[model samples]
Target: MLLGYFSLFASGFIAATLLPASSEVLLLALAQQGYKPLWLWLAATCGNTLGSCVNWYLGKELLRFQHKRWFPISQAQLAKAEIQFNRYGSWSLLLAWLPIVGDPLTLVAGTLRVRFGLFLLLVTLGKGARYALLLFLARQLW
Candidate 1:
Protein backbone atom coordinates (compact mmCIF):
# COMPACT_ATOMS: atom_id res chain seq x y z
CA MET A 1 0.00 0.00 0.00
CA LEU A 2 2.73 2.45 0.90
CA LEU A 3 4.80 1.23 -2.01
CA GLY A 4 1.94 1.74 -4.43
CA TYR A 5 1.48 5.44 -3.69
CA PHE A 6 5.23 5.99 -3.75
CA SER A 7 5.54 4.36 -7.15
CA LEU A 8 2.60 6.37 -8.46
CA PHE A 9 4.17 9.57 -7.19
CA ALA A 10 7.46 8.71 -8.87
CA SER A 11 5.74 7.72 -12.08
CA GLY A 12 3.62 10.85 -12.03
CA PHE A 13 6.66 13.01 -11.48
CA ILE A 14 8.66 11.41 -14.28
CA ALA A 15 5.73 11.61 -16.64
CA ALA A 16 5.44 15.36 -16.15
CA THR A 17 9.11 15.82 -16.84
CA LEU A 18 10.57 15.70 -20.34
CA LEU A 19 11.28 12.11 -19.48
CA PRO A 20 8.93 9.45 -20.81
CA ALA A 21 6.79 7.98 -18.04
CA SER A 22 3.13 7.16 -17.50
CA SER A 23 1.36 6.53 -14.22
CA GLU A 24 -2.04 5.70 -15.67
CA VAL A 25 -1.53 1.96 -15.88
CA LEU A 26 -0.09 1.69 -12.41
CA LEU A 27 -2.89 3.90 -11.13
CA LEU A 28 -5.48 1.66 -12.70
CA ALA A 29 -3.94 -1.51 -11.30
CA LEU A 30 -3.85 -0.06 -7.82
CA ALA A 31 -7.41 1.08 -8.10
CA GLN A 32 -8.36 -2.51 -8.81
CA GLN A 33 -6.42 -3.62 -5.77
CA GLY A 34 -8.91 -1.71 -3.58
CA TYR A 35 -6.88 1.28 -2.54
CA LYS A 36 -8.99 4.34 -1.72
CA PRO A 37 -9.69 6.17 -4.97
CA LEU A 38 -9.51 9.69 -3.55
CA TRP A 39 -6.11 9.13 -1.99
CA LEU A 40 -4.74 7.62 -5.19
CA TRP A 41 -6.14 10.46 -7.24
CA LEU A 42 -4.58 13.04 -4.96
CA ALA A 43 -1.23 11.30 -5.07
CA ALA A 44 -1.13 11.27 -8.85
CA THR A 45 -2.42 14.81 -9.22
CA CYS A 46 -0.01 16.40 -6.75
CA GLY A 47 3.00 14.51 -8.06
CA ASN A 48 2.22 15.28 -11.68
CA THR A 49 1.45 18.92 -10.94
CA LEU A 50 4.76 19.32 -9.13
CA GLY A 51 6.54 17.70 -12.08
CA SER A 52 4.99 20.19 -14.47
CA CYS A 53 6.25 22.96 -12.21
CA VAL A 54 9.77 21.69 -12.86
CA ASN A 55 9.20 21.96 -16.58
CA TRP A 56 7.78 25.46 -16.14
CA TYR A 57 10.87 26.52 -14.22
CA LEU A 58 13.11 25.02 -16.87
CA GLY A 59 11.27 26.97 -19.52
CA LYS A 60 11.67 30.14 -17.52
CA GLU A 61 15.42 29.49 -17.19
CA LEU A 62 15.85 28.76 -20.89
CA LEU A 63 15.40 32.45 -21.61
CA ARG A 64 18.90 33.02 -20.22
CA PHE A 65 20.40 30.96 -23.03
CA GLN A 66 18.22 32.26 -25.86
CA HIS A 67 21.20 33.93 -27.48
CA LYS A 68 23.45 30.90 -27.25
CA ARG A 69 24.19 28.74 -30.30
CA TRP A 70 23.27 25.50 -28.51
CA PHE A 71 19.80 26.66 -27.62
CA PRO A 72 17.30 24.01 -28.71
CA ILE A 73 14.75 26.26 -30.44
CA SER A 74 15.51 28.51 -33.37
CA GLN A 75 14.48 32.14 -33.52
CA ALA A 76 11.97 31.36 -36.22
CA GLN A 77 10.40 28.65 -34.13
CA LEU A 78 10.25 30.86 -31.10
CA ALA A 79 8.68 33.61 -33.15
CA LYS A 80 6.11 31.19 -34.48
CA ALA A 81 5.27 30.00 -31.01
CA GLU A 82 4.89 33.58 -29.91
CA ILE A 83 2.49 34.25 -32.74
CA GLN A 84 0.45 31.22 -31.78
CA PHE A 85 0.47 32.25 -28.17
CA ASN A 86 -0.74 35.68 -29.03
CA ARG A 87 -3.60 34.27 -31.01
CA TYR A 88 -4.44 31.42 -28.61
CA GLY A 89 -3.90 33.30 -25.36
CA SER A 90 -2.82 31.84 -22.00
CA TRP A 91 -5.96 29.76 -21.79
CA SER A 92 -3.97 27.21 -23.76
CA LEU A 93 -2.33 26.35 -20.47
CA LEU A 94 -5.40 24.25 -19.75
CA LEU A 95 -4.16 21.83 -22.34
CA ALA A 96 -0.96 21.33 -20.38
CA TRP A 97 -2.27 17.96 -19.26
CA LEU A 98 -2.39 16.67 -22.81
CA PRO A 99 0.48 14.85 -24.51
CA ILE A 100 2.64 16.20 -27.34
CA VAL A 101 1.36 19.78 -27.17
CA GLY A 102 0.67 19.59 -23.46
CA ASP A 103 4.26 19.55 -22.21
CA PRO A 104 5.35 22.10 -24.75
CA LEU A 105 2.47 24.33 -23.72
CA THR A 106 3.79 24.38 -20.16
CA LEU A 107 7.26 25.15 -21.43
CA VAL A 108 5.95 27.85 -23.69
CA ALA A 109 4.01 29.39 -20.84
CA GLY A 110 7.27 29.74 -18.95
CA THR A 111 9.18 31.06 -21.97
CA LEU A 112 6.43 33.58 -22.58
CA ARG A 113 6.77 34.75 -19.00
CA VAL A 114 3.35 33.78 -17.78
CA ARG A 115 2.46 34.88 -14.27
CA PHE A 116 3.56 32.16 -11.87
CA GLY A 117 0.38 32.35 -9.81
CA LEU A 118 -1.77 31.92 -12.89
CA PHE A 119 0.48 29.21 -14.23
CA LEU A 120 0.21 27.15 -11.06
CA LEU A 121 -3.52 27.68 -10.87
CA LEU A 122 -4.13 26.64 -14.47
CA VAL A 123 -1.77 23.67 -14.29
CA THR A 124 -3.29 22.43 -11.06
CA LEU A 125 -6.82 22.80 -12.32
CA GLY A 126 -6.08 21.02 -15.57
CA LYS A 127 -4.11 18.17 -14.02
CA GLY A 128 -6.44 17.77 -11.07
CA ALA A 129 -9.44 17.62 -13.34
CA ARG A 130 -7.78 15.01 -15.52
CA TYR A 131 -7.05 12.74 -12.58
CA ALA A 132 -10.51 13.25 -11.19
CA LEU A 133 -12.06 12.33 -14.50
CA LEU A 134 -9.85 9.29 -14.81
CA LEU A 135 -10.82 8.16 -11.34
CA PHE A 136 -14.48 8.63 -12.08
CA LEU A 137 -14.30 6.74 -15.35
CA ALA A 138 -12.15 3.97 -13.95
CA ARG A 139 -14.60 3.33 -11.15
CA GLN A 140 -17.39 2.86 -13.66
CA LEU A 141 -15.42 0.11 -15.38
CA TRP A 142 -15.24 -2.05 -12.27
Candidate 2:
Protein backbone atom coordinates (compact mmCIF):
# COMPACT_ATOMS: atom_id res chain seq x y z
CA MET A 1 0.00 0.00 0.00
CA LEU A 2 2.79 2.38 0.83
CA LEU A 3 4.55 1.47 -2.38
CA GLY A 4 1.38 2.09 -4.34
CA TYR A 5 0.96 5.54 -2.83
CA PHE A 6 4.59 6.40 -3.48
CA SER A 7 4.27 5.35 -7.09
CA LEU A 8 1.27 7.59 -7.54
CA PHE A 9 3.05 10.48 -5.86
CA ALA A 10 6.15 10.17 -8.01
CA SER A 11 4.13 9.78 -11.17
CA GLY A 12 1.93 12.71 -10.26
CA PHE A 13 4.98 14.86 -9.60
CA ILE A 14 6.63 13.91 -12.85
CA ALA A 15 3.41 14.51 -14.75
CA ALA A 16 3.23 18.09 -13.52
CA THR A 17 6.83 18.74 -14.44
CA LEU A 18 8.16 19.48 -17.95
CA LEU A 19 8.60 15.78 -18.34
CA PRO A 20 6.20 14.11 -20.77
CA ALA A 21 4.20 11.84 -18.49
CA SER A 22 0.73 11.38 -17.10
CA SER A 23 -0.28 9.87 -13.76
CA GLU A 24 -3.82 9.15 -14.85
CA VAL A 25 -3.13 5.61 -15.99
CA LEU A 26 -1.28 4.69 -12.84
CA LEU A 27 -4.09 6.20 -10.79
CA LEU A 28 -6.67 4.17 -12.62
CA ALA A 29 -4.59 1.05 -12.29
CA LEU A 30 -4.41 1.50 -8.56
CA ALA A 31 -8.10 2.14 -8.36
CA GLN A 32 -8.89 -1.00 -10.29
CA GLN A 33 -6.60 -2.96 -8.01
CA GLY A 34 -8.78 -2.04 -5.03
CA TYR A 35 -6.56 0.62 -3.51
CA LYS A 36 -8.21 3.12 -1.18
CA PRO A 37 -9.57 5.92 -3.30
CA LEU A 38 -9.18 8.72 -0.76
CA TRP A 39 -5.54 8.08 -0.09
CA LEU A 40 -4.78 7.70 -3.77
CA TRP A 41 -6.53 10.94 -4.54
CA LEU A 42 -4.67 12.84 -1.83
CA ALA A 43 -1.29 11.45 -2.82
CA ALA A 44 -1.70 12.37 -6.46
CA THR A 45 -3.10 15.79 -5.69
CA CYS A 46 -0.36 16.75 -3.25
CA GLY A 47 2.41 15.43 -5.47
CA ASN A 48 1.10 17.20 -8.55
CA THR A 49 0.54 20.42 -6.62
CA LEU A 50 4.08 20.29 -5.25
CA GLY A 51 5.40 19.74 -8.75
CA SER A 52 3.64 22.89 -9.94
CA CYS A 53 5.17 24.70 -7.02
CA VAL A 54 8.51 23.72 -8.47
CA ASN A 55 7.53 25.42 -11.70
CA TRP A 56 6.43 28.46 -9.73
CA TYR A 57 9.85 28.63 -8.08
CA LEU A 58 11.57 28.40 -11.44
CA GLY A 59 9.35 31.17 -12.71
CA LYS A 60 10.39 33.25 -9.74
CA GLU A 61 13.95 32.82 -10.91
CA LEU A 62 13.17 34.31 -14.31
CA LEU A 63 14.77 37.60 -13.33
CA ARG A 64 18.11 35.86 -13.18
CA PHE A 65 17.93 34.61 -16.78
CA GLN A 66 15.77 37.15 -18.64
CA HIS A 67 18.73 39.46 -19.10
CA LYS A 68 21.08 36.87 -20.56
CA ARG A 69 21.67 36.96 -24.30
CA TRP A 70 21.07 33.22 -24.57
CA PHE A 71 17.71 33.39 -22.81
CA PRO A 72 15.07 31.74 -24.98
CA ILE A 73 12.28 34.04 -23.86
CA SER A 74 12.15 37.54 -25.30
CA GLN A 75 10.82 40.81 -23.95
CA ALA A 76 7.84 40.78 -26.29
CA GLN A 77 6.80 37.39 -24.98
CA LEU A 78 7.02 38.66 -21.45
CA ALA A 79 4.92 41.66 -22.33
CA LYS A 80 2.33 39.47 -24.00
CA ALA A 81 2.20 37.23 -20.95
CA GLU A 82 1.69 40.21 -18.68
CA ILE A 83 -1.18 41.34 -20.84
CA GLN A 84 -2.78 37.90 -20.78
CA PHE A 85 -2.31 37.61 -17.07
CA ASN A 86 -4.21 40.82 -16.55
CA ARG A 87 -6.90 39.72 -18.94
CA TYR A 88 -7.35 36.26 -17.43
CA GLY A 89 -6.93 37.14 -13.77
CA SER A 90 -5.59 34.83 -11.09
CA TRP A 91 -8.82 32.86 -11.09
CA SER A 92 -7.54 31.20 -14.22
CA LEU A 93 -5.39 29.16 -11.92
CA LEU A 94 -8.52 27.11 -11.29
CA LEU A 95 -7.92 25.51 -14.64
CA ALA A 96 -4.60 24.11 -13.53
CA TRP A 97 -5.93 20.61 -14.19
CA LEU A 98 -5.92 21.26 -17.90
CA PRO A 99 -3.34 19.37 -19.90
CA ILE A 100 -1.61 21.54 -22.48
CA VAL A 101 -1.84 24.87 -20.65
CA GLY A 102 -2.03 23.93 -16.97
CA ASP A 103 1.71 23.70 -16.36
CA PRO A 104 2.41 27.01 -18.03
CA LEU A 105 -0.42 28.64 -16.12
CA THR A 106 1.20 27.71 -12.84
CA LEU A 107 4.52 29.08 -14.00
CA VAL A 108 2.90 32.28 -15.24
CA ALA A 109 1.11 32.72 -11.92
CA GLY A 110 4.43 32.73 -10.12
CA THR A 111 6.18 34.82 -12.77
CA LEU A 112 3.46 37.47 -12.56
CA ARG A 113 3.60 37.29 -8.75
CA VAL A 114 0.12 36.02 -8.08
CA ARG A 115 -0.54 35.41 -4.39
CA PHE A 116 0.85 32.03 -3.28
CA GLY A 117 -2.11 31.24 -1.05
CA LEU A 118 -4.51 31.66 -3.94
CA PHE A 119 -2.32 29.66 -6.24
CA LEU A 120 -2.24 26.72 -3.85
CA LEU A 121 -5.95 26.90 -3.24
CA LEU A 122 -6.90 26.91 -6.90
CA VAL A 123 -4.38 24.26 -7.86
CA THR A 124 -5.55 21.97 -5.09
CA LEU A 125 -9.18 22.44 -6.00
CA GLY A 126 -8.60 21.81 -9.66
CA LYS A 127 -6.43 18.76 -9.08
CA GLY A 128 -8.67 17.34 -6.39
CA ALA A 129 -11.73 17.76 -8.58
CA ARG A 130 -10.00 16.03 -11.45
CA TYR A 131 -9.08 13.00 -9.37
CA ALA A 132 -12.50 12.88 -7.79
CA LEU A 133 -14.14 12.93 -11.17
CA LEU A 134 -11.83 10.27 -12.48
CA LEU A 135 -12.62 8.01 -9.59
CA PHE A 136 -16.31 8.69 -9.93
CA LEU A 137 -16.31 7.76 -13.57
CA ALA A 138 -14.31 4.63 -12.91
CA ARG A 139 -16.67 3.52 -10.16
CA GLN A 140 -19.61 4.11 -12.44
CA LEU A 141 -18.23 1.74 -15.01
CA TRP A 142 -17.00 -0.92 -12.62
Candidate lDDT values, in order:
0.87, 0.88
Find the 10 residues in a row with the least total lDDT in model 2.
Answer: 55-64
TM-score on alpha carbons, each prediction:
0.95, 0.96
Off by over 4 Å in 2: none
lDDT of 1 by residue, 70-128 (tens): 98899899999889977878888877889877777888888888998998998889988
Error of 1 at 65 (Å): 0.7
Q: Clashes in model 2: which pairs?
A: none
Residue 99, model 1, lDDT: 82
Residue 45 C-alpha lDDT in model 2: 94
Query: How high is the lDDT of residue 46 in model 2?
Result: 92
